[model samples]
Target: MLDPELVERITARRAELDELEEQLAEQLAEVRAERDELAVAERVLERIARQLAE
Candidate 1:
């Protein structure tokens, strides 16, 4: 069995961890969006190069 103080501390720490997890998820989503945009740009560049070659 845990003491009251320890239980309170654990609860606080869990809340902090949850907030950090949310922040990390938002950052990951931004990174994924940037990566997807880059991929599209790469495909467009490749198409332009092929057109130029022909």
Candidate 2:
């Protein structure tokens, strides 16, 4: 038998944590997209250099 106030507090904290988790997930996705874009740029540069060498 839990106190109603305590249960309410716990529920509030869980919601806050859920929001933070969603924000972190979004940030992670942004970082991964940036990394992928950089990788693609590097490959393009390498290909251009190789073409100039021929």
Candidate 3:
């Protein structure tokens, strides 16, 4: 059987990992949103440039 202290340590580590995972997920979402916005801006800029060149 596992010792009580070891079990407690395992539980604590799991909680810490869960919190870290949540934080990383949120950051990933923010990064994706920024990337999408940049892509849209790039498209607009290209369109304007083409219009000006014509």
The number of the candidate with the highest TM-score is: 3
Query: TM-score of every model?
Result: 0.91, 0.90, 0.97
Deviation from truth (RMSD, Å), model 3:
0.5
lDDT of 1 by residue, 1-54 (tens): 779999999999999999999999999999999999999999999999999999
Per-residue lDDT for 1-54 in model 3, tens only? Answer: 999999999999999999999999999999999999999999999999999999
Question: After best superposition, candidate 2 residue 34: deviation in angstroms?
Answer: 0.6
What lDDT does candidate 1 reach at residue 45? 100
Model-by-model lDDT, in order? 0.99, 1.00, 1.00
Q: What is the per-residue lDDT of model 2 for residues 1-54, given as tens digits with 9 covering 90 to 100?
A: 989999999999999999999999999999999999999999999999999999
Evaluated at residue 24, the lDDT of candidate 2 is: 100
